[model samples]
Target: MSARISNNLRSAKAVAAALSDSEDERLSENSNDGSVFLVSNDEDSEIEKVKGEDVITEYEDDDEFDLETEPASKQRRLNKGADRQSCRGSRSSGNPNFSTNTKNDDMDVETPVEAFRVLFDDAILDKIIIHTNEEIERVMCLLISKEHQCQSIHKKIDKEELCAYLGLCFYSAYFKENESCVKDMWDDVFGRGIYRATLSGKRFEFLNRVLRFDDKNTRSERRATDKLAPIREIWDIFIQNCTNNFEPANNCTIDEQHKPEIIMSYNCYKGATDTFGEKSHEFSTARRTARWPLRFFYNMLDQSAVNARVAYNLNADNPRLSRKKFLKKLAFGLVEPHLRRRLGIATIRASIKKIIRKLLEIDEHVPAVVSVIKENTRSKCHLCDSNAVGRTRMKCPNCLRRMCDDHRTAICVECSAAN
Candidate 1:
């Protein structure tokens, strides 16, 4: 506010601008609020007062003083084609300062929506649609016959609409997989309010019947053991076909860019990605819960990822697919011919008596050993110290006392209750 104070500040700045080039190289940079600062070389008294430290004014100054800061009265001549010799830079005009460019050419410029659209190539989508409709019909018959209540429920899903529904489910769930339920996914796909309209179909029906398989005809001893036989076949076809089509990177290493399945470190460096910050929780959350009823979700989550990869990989495989024009006859193209070996079951279990006898023999008529707790070795009983009997075989944990097998009880109430 005052001329004298302002003069002092300017004098300090001039001195700092002078001394900045000579400080310890490894020391932290002089910075304030992220802006680079400099050291002051004001008069010894002023420097000490301003910085609250001893001022070592005897050290030599550096050439960077004038190289960086110039006095207002004495203007610096710009780097015009030099007339005199200098060591700081090449004086020739041909040696123009070449600043580095910040933009990356490798980054994908496609929008998420556009990238997503590329995944559902028309033919693969058609195959998916047909496969889906067939599943719906087959499931519908089972529901109607076994569940008489299904007589009241009726719906027909065509290929086009079913495909769209599946796409929407993926689009919504991919973004919010960790935090939201399937219903939340639907709400996101449709819109966010009581007044919002959505696709006209049965939500309950879709959830219950989507990709479910039920078969009761087989009575073989060993069949591929589970429900969802038909759906699993479809899933296998999709994974196999997509895997066959993919081309891995020429020089890309898995542990570098792609995360490893075998976890060696929890705290380790992860590579950069565009969505790294926003979707940051995915990796940590994935690591935290690696088991449980997440089997359904584990597959779905992978599908969401592979959907993106399918887009990117196909892009890299041939730029033509990514750019414009069509891929040659895209199709689900599932060939459903599979061979299986059937094992026979014995039909000679004529009486329940023989079955019971076989089960008892298998068990050897002994109840299983539920648990065993070992004890420390000891030479004598804690109670009687009897050498006449076998050496002490166990110890009392609480009191650190030894006991022979003759004196050993299954559990000592006193010792068991103690801490």
Candidate 2:
């Protein structure tokens, strides 16, 4: 029995020796691969320490791992200080020149209308008229039936009508009535009478429907590279005008509350923007529309009004001049040039002519002859059939343009004497 127990013990010792050899071989292989296994007397404690050190080393080696030993609050303070230093350095070395660069002279802004023209002048109006007429032509071409091409559609939009349309737009914004329906605003009883007086509801709707800043035919090609292709041309003109007329102060801030500067040079002018926001909200011309380009156009109109007011106030220096009054004058001024041209039209109603003369402050005067035309020579009447009328002997003495008897105005001696 003693001999059998010794044999079993020998077999157990051989198995234990085999396991120890395998463990040593694995450790030796690990060491060969540049792995260091520390030897310590306290095996369990040393194993735990090595495991902890391995985890720390892996974390440190990771590219994305941030080694922030400091508290979060302390770290944030350090970052803020660094940002402030950079901002201060940039601002100190930047451009120092800042002054008003008004393109208009004092004499040019003698009247409210004149002052308003400093920004939205005749050139802008001409461009709008051209584009509006082009849009009308496009719509006309699209109409398949004669019934679809109404008389209004056949008649091209002129500068006078465009001015009236813009005047109504401005009026709507000024009264904060843009939210109101067009029919409601034009209502005889509850509605403001100014809208109806300025333009017929249908005409106003038609103009609004066709109003465009750019040609639609070329927009696709332009839009490939320019996202703002729709309003780019007019927007460029407006930007250029603003740049020429106004200049920012030395300490101008873009967005103060959200984007603060390191060293705020001017705090007093800070409230100027806030004040403008509040006032512009009160007189905002923005109308909700699905078309982004149309919405952008509305914003442009609103900005134009505000800029005109600024230009007027700067030049006029009239403390008593209210925005409401200035806008009224500005609208009239826009319509004035067109109204003057309409005065020469023979088909215009007597009542309308009288109103135009009154608005223009024109005194009745006798027509004089500058020169006599050759008896044999005949010219078409300026007011008749788009210059297709039968030649006439009559001509305007002021402009020396040919006209018919119906186109001539006859004034009483007393009226002419008064002038």
Candidate 3:
């Protein structure tokens, strides 16, 4: 989602800082779980100033803002060593020395469902199956009622029936516009008993409430200005998970990838508008608004499928494999190399923790590395190769002094020009 969002917007840097900041929050959340950062063997890891963002936010409106896995065995040991070396190198020399791999590593590719199934127990999965069944049946009933001009009788939707129904919907998507809607799918063709259970929207709502793992009192406290002392516990967990995933970013290169804002905002704006309202910022608002809803939850589950594959690939027998190169190759191949989402940083972090912890709970046998790195190192400037800032550093819109300072409080050329 983040990758897609970046494609829509003209400026990707706009959210880089947002991501960086939330990275800390997410990392901190995992401190106790041994899932994010490997507890530093060294007591002092030097904190560098924030740097590398191309441009600061142009949003004068203050509303812009924001927001892991593990692997295993022989490969995991290498990552741990690499992580320790990277950290110590950063502290002593103020530079990043991170993952360096050859080209022969094995690749683990997942078929979506295989990876996601680890996160849910039979009970949770059953609940999902049940809810999905209800959802499909409800839509079918509505369609039937409208067509027949009478109150359609509700029916019980089972897993096999839903699967048959979905198989058609999946194929139907290629139709002129879309053939996935429940109404469009109800026929004698897909399967005879697939949708025997169809209920009206009202009836479904009455039978089962919205599925949520968080407390009813749970809500974001970030909007508060007065150094809000209390925030939800879930948010903490989410941040730690993110830090774990984001930890490997020892240095960020200033590659001239297409205009992130233009690419992402234009393409993803419609999605954000569709998901939230047009009024929300494409990444920030849309992501926060969606949070751990079933759709996002599904996406998180889907992401695990990819990560598990990556972990497997890393652990593959090829000792000569290059992890970074392998990831880049995989990026172009069948699976996504990163957990890219275009939502607010915080919300996305929460979604990750949700997926990871659930998996950890259900599949305790799964290694923590599948969802997060052993630890993260500070990012160094691609040019200077110096230890860079901790979170996000600003680039001058005026002068070229882009490597050393915090511009969050001070005004930039936009303000200077006005003066």
Candidate 4:
């Protein structure tokens, strides 16, 4: 480059450095309204330029003159800690200047990972530097808002939005130890969304008794293997269905309306863990106590807890866990030891029916039930109960008899299609 042009760029760079400080002052000085902060050797000219109708447009074309994309010169003293002192100059540090120590701390503690933590923090700082104290507090609260634990806490945002934010945190911190901690605390306090997030995180340790590749050790290994299959199968269904509407980029924003059963399952899993401690025995006891399917006791406990959580909105309840203790006992059966031997199929079915009824309130299993009900109510011919509904002849495919719509294989479309 020519020396004159280079010199001009150097001079511009120097002015830019000075302008950073001026920028903050300008932002503060015009706090109620916004004004552009311009840097130029001719102050009057720059001010006049800013006032012109096409000022931003004129400057837009000359972005190379802007400081951001420009190449740094040897004369520039940009380094750590430069922005700390200046009122308006650019902060020398990059976004996420959080120290290595902070990264390690976040990792160890399972703090949530946000997509734009650095950007968000920077924006908050910028707002603070410019806004009134009240606005600063309001913006900070928005940035750090968490899911409501109780009604007395004065809600400012919807629960689903809160869940999405929490989900973002969980999703961002995937595979981190702190993620597990966050999941645990979230489950303990909030419940429903945590199970879905945990299961999605695929950090099996966060899921109580739902054994994964890592949990296979000693007797615990065999037990976890035995307990894990059904839960895993259920999760496979849950994930496939729940994720149908969510692309990876937008996974955090699950609507409360979609995949109700999956949501129920997530809540149930969370509730079970909260009721039962993280250890295997507590899970085992809770499973038996809840009177869930004993063969897959641990799996049922995990799934059930999630269901209960989502269904009840336990996190937002006035008195959290009030129903938890009773539900656990009722589901598991705190009947005297002698009563266990005398318990019949009817009793077991009744317990299951009760759980199912409660689950319906949350509508978590509505999708699954609706799918089943639709399959059950399809049109079919009547001559024999073995014909496909749409067939022109209306003859039974299996029985080969003439049939009408009324009795043509009451088995319905799903069964016929399966055949």
Model 3 TM-score is 0.25
**Candidate 2 collision pairs:** none
How does candidate 4 fare on TM-score? 0.17
Task: Indicate the TM-score of model 2.
Answer: 0.55
Clashing pairs in 1: 16-39
Model 1 TM-score, 2 decimals: 0.31
Please count the clashing residue pairs in each candidate, in the order shown.
1, 0, 54, 35
Residue 301's C-alpha lDDT in candidate 3?
A: 32
lDDT of 4 by residue, 1-419 (tens): 23343454444444444444565432222333333434455433322223332213322323333333445422233421232234112212422221112212222211111211211233332322232233334434654676423231222322222223323332322222222343453453454332332222223221222212211224255555575532343334444432332122211113333342243123222322333333322223221222232234334333333333323332232234333342333232211221222222243333333333343332322211112122223344454446454533455555555455555335443333222
| Lowest lDDT block of 10, candidate 3 | 278-287
lDDT of 4: 0.32
Order of candidates by TM-score, top first?
Answer: 2, 1, 3, 4
lDDT of 2 by residue, 5-73 (tens): 334334333433443446553333144444433433443322112332332242232212223445754
Root-mean-square deviation per candidate: 30.8, 21.0, 35.1, 27.1
Off by over 4 Å in 4: 1-232, 238-300, 314-320, 323-326, 329-419
Residue 49 C-alpha lDDT in model 3: 20
Per-residue alpha-carbon lDDT of candidate 3 for residues 1-419, written as tens digits (9 for 90 to 100): 33333232323344543445465433231333332212223434322223322222332111121111223344545664565555545534633333322232222224322222223224444554655445545556676778854232234544433322222222222121121334333433552121212222233232223334333332244325422212223233433443343324333222223343343223222221222221111111111123335334433332333333334444445333333333223322221111122111343333343333342343323222211111233333233435544432434333423333333235333223223
Model 4 vs truth, CA RMSD: 27.1
CA shift at 18, candidate 3, in angstroms? 18
